[model samples]
Target chain A: MKRLKLFPISRRAKDLLAGKLMLLLTILAALLVLLMVAGLYLKSRPVLASQPLAELLFSTKWRPFRGQFGFFPFIMGTLWVTGVAVLIAVPLCLLTAIYLSEYAPARVREWVKPLIDILAGIPSVVFGVWGMLVVVPFIKDSVAPFFKVFSTGYSILAGGIVLAIMIFPVIIHVALEVFRAVPQEVREASLAVGATRWQTVKHVVLRKALPGVAAAIVLGIARAFGETMAVLMVVGNVAKVPGNVLDPAYPLPALIANNYGEMLSIPLYDSALMLAALILLLVILLFNLLSRAVLARVERSIR
Target chain B: MDRRKVEEGIFRVLMVLATGLILSSLVMILLTVLVKGLPYLSLEMVTQTPRGGYYLGKGGGILNAIIGSLYLAGGATLLAILFSLPVALYLNVYSRPDARFVSVCRLAFDVLNGVPSIVFGAFGFTLMIYFGLRASLLGGIIAIALLILPMLIRAMDEVIRLVPRELMDASYALGATRWETALRVVTRQALPGILTAVLIAFGRGIGDAAAVIFTAGFTDAVPTSLLRPAATLPLAIFFQLGVPVPEVQGRAYASALILTLLILIISVAARRLSRRLTRHVVK
Candidate 1:
């Protein structure tokens, strides 16, 4: 401790200075998060206040050009697309997770896990282009035609399919963690009772990991809900509630992403999109927090 | 017993099929892009900017977008690292494991991370309008920095948390200050994780389009300053895909291929480099 003070600052004071820097940095991070939420609300206040919240949420019509700004079509579009995505994805993801955790050898698991992660990391824009160039054409040329439905390449089915593929990895990754958390002793005990390996995974592992799996599914749905570019590219961007999977739909993110630029010129257009963005933020935030709470509880048990 | 056996076999088969399908999508996604993009993947395609009528499948390349994306994502990644590193360090170093502040911060990050990238664009648009900032590279960088902050910080925090606390305590007991312990000991222990976090942020920042779409303001020319509008690979793909021409659509695939390849290189390098860095770590 017998050293010359650095510019009149003591060692304890230096420690305090370092601590203060960290505290300030943490405060900045928190403030930034708050700013994002506050910014959305304040910016959208005009549209949010002008109409009843229920009307904006439940009204079936949306006409930006004629000044009608009911966002129900977009909300339903988002729900229909995300719901179909989760519907298509959850079962597939759960099965894959079970296979990875129970059936695959250690060597196989190591190689396969990274591929799944890479799938998760593939950019939305890449997926968007692929959907535009391939999936839409396939749906139009084959899938929809086979069903004898009136179809454009871009429709809710295309959007949902793209989202299903995109959200698969998120669900599978989470489900894997859940499955791995199932105690080895419990698995052995189930097998010892003359249960088949598949039986143990089905009855024991599945039951044990149900909550985590649900959380995983919720996370996937949240991601599907929030997705913008890919869904926008494939969903046909029509501001109407999709009648069926083959119908064109405009999701909220798609609506915002597509029109926010031109919105500045149109009266109340910017505010409407801002309100849509705010709704998306709230929904996604709720889903994420719910999933996080579940995961946290599961983590405690697994630990 | 016979029924159970049949069900088990059926389920096993279904599992294999499901896993196979999931994995094949990745291969299919990659192969489709590679096949469609390779013919258009020439030096000229990478070297030249879009000439007039470029969207109609006319001459020139996506050079402006390529450079501009590198600039914006790269700049944003750098900025995110500076702020995220400290926040991550603060979470792991300055606070107890179950501290309220730490939990609140983590929860906040969760919410931020959950908020869609397009919302970030909206928020950025809001702030830019308020501050009199035009759509430019700076606006995009800042927006993307905010977008990736939670991701980067959470990733780094996870990595730093994995470093054994005993190692940090030992460093502090050796008369090293908290700053020194954090800088020299904790950072070294988690170097690989930090590198991986940085790489992930880089990949995310580069690949993301929605957050920067409103803020970046697409341009055909490469940005010469932070104030100038910039073109990103994702936006380039979006614009080209919008063109009705088949030739232009092929270029969209080509651009997506380029963007995918960049992310691939970063991930591959990060994995290999992380493995190498772990050789020096005590863990």
Candidate 2:
């Protein structure tokens, strides 16, 4: 009490000041996404104003020098690559999550957890390098030829494979958390009712964890969609709609990454690129919000 | 019953195979980097800046990128912490966890976390153009700081939330204000977790490439001022690999090796440091 009197302000005032400051910071943080969206949208207004949103989104022509910016190709490219990645990654990750949650010994689980972290921690550039060195060549020489297709390996399939590997940790980590959140009593009850271990996991744990798993998959799709460097390295950056997995695709992030620097001099080029970024931001924002809502529901249901 | 047993055995095998496949990919990625990089990774690669025709397989090292990345990530991490710590503390100590404001803040961070690094790069570039700032270390720092801020806050919040309510109550009973209780007691209790969060942000900041690519203009010289352009190892790897020369491509592997080693060291050190600091934690 004696020391408290040394302050120029009352203790209550100091506490209020600190609390206010923290609240302000939190508010600022909460407002950042809107700030980003507004900033990007303002910058991209030129292109958005020049062309109809539908034409811009649905048009496949992407001639910047000619002042026509059609994002259809890039949008489709992103979808194709992300689609391939999600298709390949979900089953593999779900199985691994189940094994770790339902079947693995404690020692193995301990070892794999850190391993997943390390995998997740590996820089995207290194993954790019690995894809460039191994996956691309293997696809070029072996996989493509085995399918009797003559192709350069830098295709949507290559991008998808690399993206799938990059997102393994994201999916597996969340899936593991979701699986663990399934109460042990549920499992025990299933076992007591004469369900085998695998049966219990399939019927009880998996059903309970379904929403969480879907959320995880959504997060993974968000990750794969926004991935830039590794996909850029392998997914031959041609500005065309990829008809098949073997064709080159220019994804939106890649479009922004590859051209934003060099083509600033072109009329409306930067705006088009900003519009691409806005598209990516919006889609990712939608996915993240959706996943968060689903996760909240899962938490509520669990409780 | 027999058929059900067969199906169980089949699924068990599938699960094991899937797990093995995932783990082996990690091993394979590491092995590829090491095998391809070791031959080109000379001591000079880390010590000297690039010389004339370095990208042509002639001479020099990636020291510029090495130091530049350290500076950029270090600066960004510090900047992020300045903002992140307050938000994290406010969430746990000053505000109700279930408050609408808190949920909105948490939701904001989640969405921001999911926003791609390329989007950050684009947004940062837009900001720089508006402010008439060139692509420089400062520009990169601001971008990466924004990129990692949400992550840092969320991670710190998770740990700070775990601090026992009783600890804060005891501090309050001793006539301490909420400010003092938060800064001294709760923060001290969550020190290790805070450290881990900081290091994780640092790791992410350093390893990031797409966010910095446009904002951090690459330069051969090491950056001496915040206004100057700086190179990063990931971009260095990217540029080297793009050259058609075999030797330059080999150097790309060397650069990737350096970057990977840096991240590995950061993660390992984070774990070790957290373990050491845990002794001081009340829990």
Candidate 3:
């Protein structure tokens, strides 16, 4: 009000405001990223400081109470559970995506897609509850009996099955997108070669969509690794490294979920959880970067 | 030919089974929760504060938790929208084309999107405690706002970019100022899409429990104030009934079902509304 200037919207003011907003957002993002890095660093220092890094890296036990903190068990547990999940999910998800994209009538795809979308919208805790009551029991009574040679009770198998169910939609959504992105000529050319419908999908469509499929798989792995509630509820929460797929074992995220709230506000425990979080963040970030790279490669290859 | 037909038939069956299993999991979860918790879902559960064991049924109701969820999520959504919208607008308008600033913002948004919720919770806990807020709803709202801000900005930027450039030209040709044109014409026409972005972010915030868990420490007796601790449905599921009690477990299932239904309904509605608006604009 004090200024009746001819050009109130000065160039300097515009640039200044833009610079200030950019600085604010950058600082916030930087702080969040730094906290994650620092938190992990502080948390993992004990293990990192100990001698014989080889043993720590290769050891199967994760007895932090006695200060024997080998991450192999946790890492293996995560991979095994998620691998089994991917094994169960990938085929089913691909099939569903194919059915939706290719086989299903338009109206049917429309109906199914929204349901899948809504399924994704449901909270993870609800899935956890469902896993606890329904999935765990099914595993306990049905699958465990068949797998008694390896494990007679709740195991990674149960957790993996539940996780597969949880992540199926993500795979389907991404795969469907990739399938749709494949060019029409490829499909027609493959069909012109007298390939059956399945052959066209298997050879032409899926091969063309391989890069996207890889991205989707990596994304599914990322989601599975960070997931907490459902796995914690069904995995039996054992802290041991499993010798077989049927054995109960803990993953890093589940450990944090179960122990973070209970641990006294001590630096060691806080750092431990933070270290676990750091590991999770790093794994997820690495894969995210990998997917971006894959997408970039796909763009390049296409061009 | 017969062999190929048989193989195709088998593949079709497997496809149906795959779809069936996914659908069944969804149905099974919903049906199990509804069957177990439906009878217990009374007006009191929705209206009053939670008491002791759900069986004893002596507590007030879930009204406080519901209100806390609404306020925390609503406040977070508002802040995210408030900050991100303008920032997105500025980035769209002021930043030189292909500038380092724009790329940096894009990278930050990507990192934010990929940063896990638990990590966000830990950061919030440390930073809020450092500020002496201890665990409160404001802290939770702030944490969620951070989590949703990147997504909000990206969505808003997309919708804003979709705003036709001819409109900008028209306004400028009329001797309207830069601010006036942006505020009056472009924004007014882009309002629906922006609202859609806000709704999507709000829905995402509402369903999020990890970001809220550490920032808003769980409280049993309804949140009397923003400074006070509060229980959300997701937190309640994680904390209260995570044990082996039947009644408590029942209550948790009921709460989970309710929370899931609310989020799903709102998210679906928001997404459909946004899609409709975009389609209308395009037409």
Tell me each candidate's TM-score.
0.97, 0.98, 0.89
Q: For each prediction, how big is the interface RMSD?
A: 1.3, 0.9, 3.1
- Candidate 1 runs further than 4 Å off: A1-9
Residues A56-133 of candidate 3: C-alpha lDDT, one tens digit per residue: 556776665665656677777788889889999999998888888878999989889978977876777777777777
TM-score of 3: 0.89
- Which consecutive 10 residues in model 2 chain A have the weakest lDDT in total? A2-11
Q: Give the DockQ (2 decimals) of all models.
A: 0.76, 0.85, 0.44
| Candidate 1 local lDDT, A131-215, one digit each (tens) | 9778999999999889998688899989998999999988998888888888899999999999999899878989998899999
Q: What is the DockQ of candidate 1?
A: 0.76
Ranking by lDDT: 2, 1, 3
> Which docking class does model 3 fall in?
acceptable
Candidate 1: residue B168 Cα off by (Å): 0.9
Query: lDDT of each structure?
Result: 0.89, 0.92, 0.74
Ranking by TM-score: 2, 1, 3
By TM-score, the better pick of 1 and 2 is 2
